[model samples]
Target: MDSEESRCFSGYDGNRFKLVILASQRAHELSSGAATMVDRQGDKNTVVALREIASNQLDLSTVFGLAVQRCRKYLEEFAGSRGIAGHSSHVSPSRSSRHTGLGKSFVDNKSTYSASFLDQDKFLSGGKDDGIKGF
Candidate 1:
């Protein structure tokens, strides 16, 4: 049984740390009310633990996969809550967010960008009198 145990312990492709963690978890579960898959006539918990490890009952990759799924769910929930907590506007912002010298009505009723609505007199006279910065 020692050779078989060594073979099982060494056959694991992943890190030994992960394997020990998973095996210890499985042993705890087995010692609890969890059902055992292999035959258990007069087996001790150590034998059962080794057999469980050898039989591929507890896979580190599968455990990591489940943990990843749970982490993703938790992160998504956190992000969603943050979005709701910090969210303010369902409608669009005002046209003058920055200090741009333009008003809501500077563009015509059609859109914010109107090709024919040029302030040509202000530009040609070169005076500081656009009167949009007063607001």
Candidate 2:
């Protein structure tokens, strides 16, 4: 390995395995159109990732956190597409429609509920109903 590559371990607190994993993940990001943190200098994505790590330019926490968020969003969409309800068992069903004065069974009305599920921001914000109905 190049001296820079060897130095990459320091970025992960001397954890060689973590350095490798994080570098590969960063390389994947580069290939997926993420901007490089270090100058490209005609180097491959893997090399750029290693250099960024070696120079301590990469934010490791953000890398791991973004991956987690992407996985969570994917799982939520997958569950919703499969007609699965809320992923958490602790949140009572009544909470989903509490502001609308609709009973828990309101979610069972697919015609009305589907729109809310698709626009999760509005549904989750707990705003008052607009007093309107779909035609």
Candidate 3:
């Protein structure tokens, strides 16, 4: 306990929780492509974080703010790139048809989504569904 207590920094004022959060956030950021502010002689994230915290290279405000910014950026990118189209979920047949060689023979033969399902109004809920009429 003596060594652990002695190695502690005055910046945290003995707040172990704050130290842990700061270190963990820094470590996460480091793992997510952020460069280390401290020199790391093959030290892993925990060691780097601890060294940064001990030397006051990291701060609580920066950690919390970075987390929020990264989260927002992730969500924006997520909404931006939802599918292969990378545009909208409701893809029209004409727009989707542009994707050439999408296993047309395989899809037509092996799946229920055959050529019969291509009608714009047939699949929609507006008209009466004549079951297997197109088949």
- What RMSD does each model have against the real structure? 24.1, 14.1, 19.0
Q: Estimate, for each residue in 11-52, the C-alpha lDDT of model 1 and write its tens digit.
A: 555444444545565666677766876776577765776687
Candidate number with greatest lDDT? 2
Give per-residue lDDT, candidate 1, residue 51. 82
Clash statistics: count for each candidate = 0, 0, 0
Question: CA lDDT of each candidate?
Answer: 0.49, 0.59, 0.55
Q: Order candidates by TM-score, high to low.
A: 2, 3, 1
Write down the TM-score of every candidate: 0.38, 0.44, 0.42
| Candidate 2 global TM-score | 0.44
Model 2, range 1-135, lDDT digits (tens) per residue? 467666555445443444555678788899999998888988899888888878878777666555445545765575576555643343355765464544233334423433333333332233454232341
Decoy 3 TM-score against native: 0.42
Candidate 3 per-residue C-alpha lDDT over 4-123 given as tens digits, one digit per residue, 9 for 90 to 100: 434666434443544565577788988888888778878888777788767766665667456545544654564345432323344457855896544343233323222342332343
For model 3, the superposed segments whose C-alpha errors exceed 4 Å read 1-12, 68-135
